[model samples]
Target: MHRHFQGLALLAVAAALAILAPVFCAERPAAAGAAPSPDSQSAAPVVIQVDAAHPTGPYSPAWNYFGADEPNYVYSKNGEKLLRELAALSPAPVHVRLHNLLTTGDGAASLKWGSTNAYREDADGNPVYDWTITDRIFDAMLDAGVQPLVEVGFMPEALSTHPEPYRHDFPKGDIFTGWSYPPKDYAKWAALVTAWATHLRDRYGVESLNGWLWEVWNEPDINYWHGTPEEYDRLYDVTAQAIRSVLPNALIGGPDSTGPGTGRAAEFLEQFLEHCLRGKNSATGGTGAPLNFISFHPKGSPTEVDGHVRMGIQRQLAAMDRGMKIVASFPEYKHTPIILGESDPEGCGACSVATNPSDVYRNGPLYGVSVAEAEARTYELARKNGVVLKGSVTWALEFEDQPYFAGFRDLATNGVDKPVLNVFRMLGMLTGEWLPTTSSGGLPLDDILNSGVTRAPDVNAIATRSEHEVDVFVWNYHDDDVQVPPANVHLNVDGLRQGRVRVEQFRMDSDHSNSYRAWLDMGSPAAPTPEQQAQLERAGKLETLGTPQNLKIAGGRLPLTFDLPRQGVELVRISWR
Candidate 1:
């Protein structure tokens, strides 16, 4: 979830810097590590080789997680629809995270803000607890077949150290208000958290919460917490104790700091790990704290250059590289699960293309292809660093009462789906063990780490094989958002059962599975007719390129050829008789 913060200069040492969140500006300036535009030229046909007999490891759905900033949108008409879609996309469990769950408000949601009025105090320094709004949000999630990554967050009004200006008008004024401060009374804060957890247990049963994840606060290394590092540690210790006291088996961990590429954020993460490992716990006077998982956020730094958007894939990857290395440095917690709490192309999902033109990629196939490439590379990074990646939360969801295709960084606009969500639908189809795959035209991981895919397009594929089926996901991605010639792709599969095979292909591009373009072809209507809405709904679904074909496998090998457009994503599924 995006939260506006006060701007501070971040120094980049050795190609590592903190990618700042969105600011209110006409055009965002290019950062130091932003990828330069690549030459527009056609290249060779890529060859992707997949061996179904050899399995590298088990395939984990690390990209199945998603989140947003507005918590009150959980039950909105559009929000509920989108949640059901997300839950249906994956056979595995889908988890949703949100911000402002504990903020003080009257159950309203807006840009970069949400509230449940979960806690407040009455006269004579007494405690008053309310769980009506919170229960509503959780119930909506459970009803939709999704789990909540409960983000214990932003201070309640009565408990804040500076409660005069609890809520601030975002995008027009200072967002780091009193809600960003620490609690004035630690005991009251602990009791509030304990009561909240107890109520949830009593209402939903203990088994339900054992499967969910609980974390304390967001990005405290920045303005998300106005307190010092020690104070944040104290808050986490107390909060973890409160939750554990109620549900001892709940999966809980925290200090979800910003990207550790910057020196300050990296230092904060290291300090927190030290505190959890050896420092005294303020809650129980124990020697160490309970930490089941570690979390951080890594965002790109896209900017408009030469009247087009250029992605900062290297910037985001650099942050992940630094963070994973940090987690691996400690032998005591080297194998703990690590989650990229808010992974995205850039920060500030609430910022639209109208003001910041760099975000124009959100409404097109670029967003989908970019996510595909980023996730594939992240899995590679985790393997390189020898860490178990829990998941990378895509911080985009549906926004209500918005114009169609307004270019907000979201999976859907109003009620219709965007091209990016189709990528997840494709990812959901992948199951079983990962097959050994290699691409001739793919860029080396080190090369992309040093410089992004600026010299050539990354034409790669991730393939998996089940008992009777094989799935291959391919993408043609470039950092610059400009039209170029399509790449010819040759997909080869080996070790398949020798018999008749049914081959099917699904695609997401400009002409297929894109609702934004469909809306534009309908003359960009403010309020579309019923016919147009139905047409767009059909266009939004994942569509196959052509009818499924039955082909004969000769000597257990099959070769297929196709042309993949720039910024296009495709999935191929083959089943043998």
Candidate 2:
């Protein structure tokens, strides 16, 4: 439960690092808040090619997973608007994970906490389960074309074994308070779960609710859970058994531990898996519990280094690597879908830049760039470890009525989408079969995962070719917060019909699709007028770099060119006839 100590840095040193070619030649600083370019340029650029004809793997949509700490916020004005935006981003249903669904409260939400008032008791202390608030939360998701990852957690006041201090007040800086305690009665806890599952099935229909994911709790390997390991194990067993009693086809899995790269947390996950596979069920007296999937939390540790915020992408990747390795060790779960319960740039999405300078990245384009890198690496990791990655939840969403650019790790501020959200929109545009891609300027996956883009910056791209179109996403990412020169990329298309091609480019940069920069440019107005708000909303959307163009390729091979600024992402789509 300790949060102070830094995890052990596990880097893959044996992986080779490829020196990317300086294709764009000139080292010019990137415009729109990107890194400043070098003084001059060099030659002998590496030529990265995309072979669209050869398919590699399935283009699983991992970008659709999003979440937040406050479950009640899903029904808020901004929360509803943001959910619609997320829903429109992808064709698939957006899966959102939230905490404090069953905690006792008046349906209030805040940074690092939330409550639904799903359980309570009378003066005589009779069990009372209320699904009113919980139903509204799920209703909002379903109405917005989204579904809940369905995190059932945080012991309610009436059910908590240690209910002396039930409610956690984060405004008063109370964390992991009495709500983190275990339940007083196991049968009652299981009954609560059964009622929850039955209510969901009856309300949403069994077929619809069956597709939803149910996780036991938040990060139990950390301070979020106060119970002993065995106690938590028994809790999980009862929770699972109870949920299944109502909806037998329900998909559920958990133990959502902290970063597995951390020594103690890694050991905790291993032991938990061993408990599920080998250890006997504390409640049912069986060999194991029903584990349909596996889940864990991994967070990046960003800090101000050398007067700049350098993101710990390596730390997050190491945790994923270790987590997959641990799961792979168990032959039973090797094929289980692994869900990254919560993935983000750092911990405490509510912590503001006023409190921590390192979080300043949230209000800018770096957040978007980091997301692009994270998406590519996650798929790469799953392939390397031979695992099925069902989803990876981005645990920060909108904080309603928050000041503009407050520096909270959210996709939007006060209803205006951030640059990072645009990245997800770009990812949503890419679907269908996966095309093999190579980038001369892109760093090796191992290098980016282990050391980040600190060495020379990674100008990378991934291509997806569908039946009639090819989409290539490119980015210029660097760990350090400094803005560097934009890298001009020359994308070579290897296999395409020699005919008319229509190309479009969507970009996320300081000036193009970033509302934060627009807000700053407007003198950081605390209260923007109607016109200004309209302008900000427009800027927050996915913007195109230039007018759409048509190309006539003589042969089946074509060459495309574009400039990607540091901490910027560009999606180039080409449709051919």
Query: Which candidate gets the maximum TM-score versus the true structure?
Result: 1
- Tell me how many clashing residue pairs each candidate has: 0, 11
The 10 consecutive residues of candidate 2 with the worst lDDT sum are 15-24
**Among all candidates shown, the one with the greatest lDDT:** 1
* Model 2 clashing-pair count: 11
- Per-candidate TM vs. native? 0.93, 0.92
Off by over 4 Å in 1: 1-41
Q: For residues 1-577, could you state the per-residue lDDT of candidate 1 as single tens digits?
A: 4443212122222111001000001111222453433333344578888888787778888998899989888799888999999999979999999999999999888888899999987888898888999998999999999999999988999999888777777677778888899999999999999999999999999988888999999999998899999999999999999999999988887778988889998999999999999999999998879999999998887755555667888888989999999999999887899989988888888876445544556888988998998898888889889888998999999788877876688998877889999999999989888988887767777777787777677888898887888999999988877767787889999988788999999999877898878877777798989888888888889999889999999988989999888889999999974
Candidate 2, residue 210: Cα displacement in angstroms equals 1.9
